[model samples]
Target: MAGARVTTGSRLGVRIREVPVPADLDAPDAWLLRGQVDTVNEVEIALRGNRDMCRNPHETLGSMREQRYTTKIRLVAVDEDRPGDAADPARVLGHAALHLPRQDNTHTGEVDLGVRPAARRRGIGSALHDAALEVARVHGRTMLTTTTQQTSEPTDGPLALAPSTGSGRLHRDDPGVRFALTRGWSLEQVSRYSVLDVPLPADVLAAHRAAAQAVAGPDVRVVLWESRCPDEWVDQFALLQTRMSTDVPHGGIARHADVWDAARVRTIEQQFLDQGLGYLVAAAEHVPTRTLVAFTALAATPVTDEFVFQNDTLVMREHRGRRLGMLVKTANLQRLAAERPAVQRVGTWNAEENAHMLAINVALGFRPAGGTGEWQRDL
Candidate 1:
């Protein structure tokens, strides 16, 4: 592998191949690896080309898994000829990627590319893109999509993101965005980040609690679940996963079967528990029927800023105006506040046009911090 990568940065003997599981050594001077791994060695290096933690290598990796496809492409560009002796041996020169999945109706998730300052606009970015598009077409899928931070700074510079840990900041002029635009990808969906500058104020929280209490009634019970909850709920969690698409505005829709499964639910539940966080779910119990309507859930993991990650707040068509969204969010927020009181601020991203969820967030006092436009190219 070292012999293959020995080259000068001015010219790369680039090679792109779809070698699965065990990667191939003779594949290329420049390379990409795909699939789930217990380790990422350093994807963060490619994501944090900005000052703010706008690019999430962790979340991006999760997206690939959540979509039940390996939308993950790991690129390695090194001076193959110079590998044996340099101040920093095997110094990666360029990194760009996209995840491709057949189950996603041939959908692909393109990511921002990061390049070392010594190499830019020299066709490396174009080559990465060409590789992504080829995958989309070969898989019999029609669309390829990705997101980038909307910024006014220069986007073709020498910034980099640390790998794995979702903490490094990306520069506004990071080369990833520049490569995305230059390659002809256009806006698809816009994802915005909301930051709670202050806490979810006292009085407003009181009023929200009252609202949930006022309407939750005796039949609908809101509950918080930690690892201690009965494992039998995995079936219910699996069902809830199918309802996730009720409100999100992402471009390519994931198949219900791909997102819902008892085993997958158990894995996610365990992951939350292992991380010392749980989720809030609202269920309506009808004593007469002996069944529960699993309506919504809000889950979060404690990161540097205490992310109040919210997902899947679904209401049956018959229950829409009943404020179930507010009920679920309020329950989760109160639970987190009471339990993990150290958690100060909450943040979430909503489609610019998802008024229902937006209304709920605004009512809960989540304010907009930034927005990202989802771009797609039809193959």
Candidate 2:
């Protein structure tokens, strides 16, 4: 639904337009859309210099289309084609996307913006952001959220194994940080990124698994599922999903609680399928009640075999005494090894203050990889 009208910078011939994906999205448009990620990745590489990164626009767009969360995407393009431009004439210079979640976090909208390295400081980012903020306002969102990364700081201890920013590399300051602060965004939360190298030493994996197994005891059972939850466990699984909003530590950030039902759970599961990404889930069950007491998930995209994303590990409070968290996590690690053997490592994020979860991750050999600042601004 791209119209002839432009949103900004007519004098510079930079046009900002919506890239709508109708139900019947065609190959040509999809290819064009995916190129934007490539441009963004190029910029990321220049900034990050290859610290394990992967982005699949196919999954991003498809997931957005299927999820209950609505999204508005705006792309800035130059009318004149440039040499080596993947998208000619309407060469995508940058883009911004606003995500509005339906279940909860209704008062908040997440915003992500990226500008090509060569296109920075040309007002494309600001223009796209302006348009995105307008869209958020139209949807009645009161707060805008975004994340920015700083180069990993030097550290000793287990985190020392993580990659460094190279000598003389600036650590604290970044253009994104300045951009957000200048626009009135306030830092809300800091989450540390970590990665676990795959194929942990036989002794290490065995020791951790044995220790967790001993704590889990005979009354607890582990369950494994791919992509979809079974009908019988759907309700319990949904409850656990809802609990994550309150259970997980969010630091000082104002996180909205979520309400999840079986149908909504299935909708999210289906959205992963629509994105063509692989999903692996592991849950622990209480033997007597046959109830799912804890769960964790890992997602892998076809774009890269080098890394997989570890997401959402949650254990119910009543089930906390046992090592259910460790059990389910180790169980999923075993699954990830068998199913996605090509994956070389797994990356995860944890709030800086979540000592319990961080301890579990450290026990599993996940070392600090980087850090990101979660910023928020009142609309």
Candidate 3:
């Protein structure tokens, strides 16, 4: 139960309260969760011209239950006068989530904050940020990281702010960008958001896969699976995941290697299943060694047929020269098209500095859709 509410400066009578996670979507307080889903979807649509990133209420609740290095706290800004029901889209003026990693990087916290378009300039966002900051301080977190989305790269000028990486820029006037800058946050890195319209010509996918296989040589083979990892390959998959933590480009964002093991991998897979989401994984196996060397994954919810998210793509250091990245990615894309034909578009994010992977994406027909800035602040 949410115990207390603090009113903000907005004349809309907006109040901030900690939302309690319900046992299940059917719980009475589930209305709060539904309101959160509505608020997030509206915000994404307003910013990106689409709601492809929105999670359904069930998926939102499931994320709260994840115990793998994550403890989630959500705060919602609600209008006192127009406290609408579960069906109301604008009931929640804005919301913020603080994710505290328990196993590692305890000194750091991740924040996700958003406000409805019509409700901006009303102090709702500031109230939520203040509430999140206080909670983070109480938990002993010294650093905070958040992300802002931009639909286009900002040109070199007074209104554009370049990240420390110097590879991408964001408009200084974007509400999220301005909010973070005013709060002492610094731009750390920028990630390019790309989208690929799926169901590529069968011949195109086959040719790409064939070319990658030839470059990878006869010593490596691709293995595909849906939902859970096969018991035989789970441990090797875990090792690839651990490598994924440190192998990627992280710019100036403070982060530690996320340790992963067989058990942890299974836990994450189960979480995805419980959330009513389906995922596809394609791993490159070195035939001689009989071990998984590289992997990539894609996930989608049944809620929408138009969008799917390309989660992670990593090739082990020693395995890099052989084009395993292209092999696993092309293999998975083919599988995704066959298994989830309704998914018309695949969305993915890559660090602007990650040239190799971006090149592969470009060849696969993914065009730049937008960019996201990873911002950090030390408390």
Candidate 4:
């Protein structure tokens, strides 16, 4: 039912259509893609005060092409009532993305929905959610996952709703929270969203790196690269990604280990490059075996010089105590400062229950900004 149009009986005459993936940036309908990205960023900024989580339109399109996951994009628009009402005949109000993993976690699908701030209370979000649910059911997905962001933790009162993890709470009165609760979704876990001001003092970073190196000993060394992974370490890097899927604290979220290999790794790398993103990776090598025992990645888009994102940072379970996490993170941050000095901030998210990683982030001077609630529903 891709591209099928459905009109709703609202004052604005809202229409929801499944968007087809464009061939390139110059495609005729590419404006819809840009509109989707704009809507999401607008909603995020309205909720959290910063558009740190905004995705480049090129990246979103490239991700849509990945074989490992099937992503369906849907856009909600309002029909113009007058001939000269607006520049665009259909003004985009919001969008929804339903992601179905092809390999592991086949029974689970992820639904991400957002509505423009000025367009809320118009039943647009509920319409998009209902469409996503129908699509998930059609795909035979038994479980669905989504998230809601809040700028601050709600006080412990009647309006607060705590997750089963019991670590963080979200305000029950929040529109997103209320939307999910009334639909049978449960708050599974809360994740702390943090930001670190970049270009930290050179001496401070040097001291942290030196100390971590001492603890890691001579047996472990760090290797840094940009854009692509060298052939020698590609296999090991893939293994770490596979481990990351299961090793991270999920906290009651129904998910399974994601399988990754060298080919999948290479595909994503190429996608990132095509999306105009600059990514740097630092991996800790076990000198004896010459395997990547830990790794961390930092990425930024040239569209914005002031911000970068902290991607996955995973240290193998067996290599946890040697401060390798700190070692790789510091190495990457130092490199980021040297290569992309324009970046003034780095943003990241971690499960609130993951104390070890949280402690590491805290030591790096990252401060809490906001948090997200992982919501799940079993159909």
Strongest candidate by TM-score: 3
What TM-score does candidate 4 get on C-alpha atoms? 0.94
Candidate 3 Cα misplacement greater than 4 A, ranges: 1-5, 8-10, 83-90
Per-candidate Cα lDDT values, in order, are 0.51, 0.74, 0.87, 0.84
lDDT of 4 by residue, 1-379 (tens): 4433444564555666666678986787766777787787788788767666677678778766665555454554544342553435237787888888877888998888898888777777877888788888888899999999888788789998889999888889988899999999999999988999989999999999999999999999999999999999898889999999888888889898998899988988987877778889999999999889999999887558899989999999988999999999999999999988888999998998989889999999999987899999998
Preferred candidate (lDDT higher): 2 or 4 = 4
Comparing candidate 3 with candidate 4, which one achieves the higher lDDT? 3
Which 10 successive residues of model 3 have the least lDDT summed?
A: 1-10
Poorest 10 consecutive residues of model 2 by lDDT? Answer: 161-170
lDDT by residue for model 1 over 1-379, one digit each (tens)? 1112223356665443332322232334212332112112233323333222332333333333343334455554543344553323134555545565434344444544544544555565566556556655656657667666543222233553221222222343445555555777654455556656335666777789678656756666665565433455566656555556443455432322345567767666654554444465555433344344444554554334444556566665555666666776776666666766666666566665567878788877777665555666667
- In angstroms, the error of model 3 at 173 is 1.9
Separately for all candidates shown, the number of backbone clashes (residues 3 or more apart, or on different chains) is 28, 0, 0, 0
Cα-based TM-score, every candidate = 0.66, 0.87, 0.95, 0.94
Best-to-worst lDDT order: 3, 4, 2, 1
> Model 1, residue 272: displacement in angstroms?
5.5
Native-to-model Cα distance after best TM-score fit, residue 129 in candidate 3, in Å: 0.6
Descending-TM-score candidate ranking: 3, 4, 2, 1
Q: Give the poorly placed runs of model 4, Cα more than 4 Å off.
A: 2-10, 78-90
The window of 10 residues in a row where model 1 has the poorest summed lDDT is 30-39
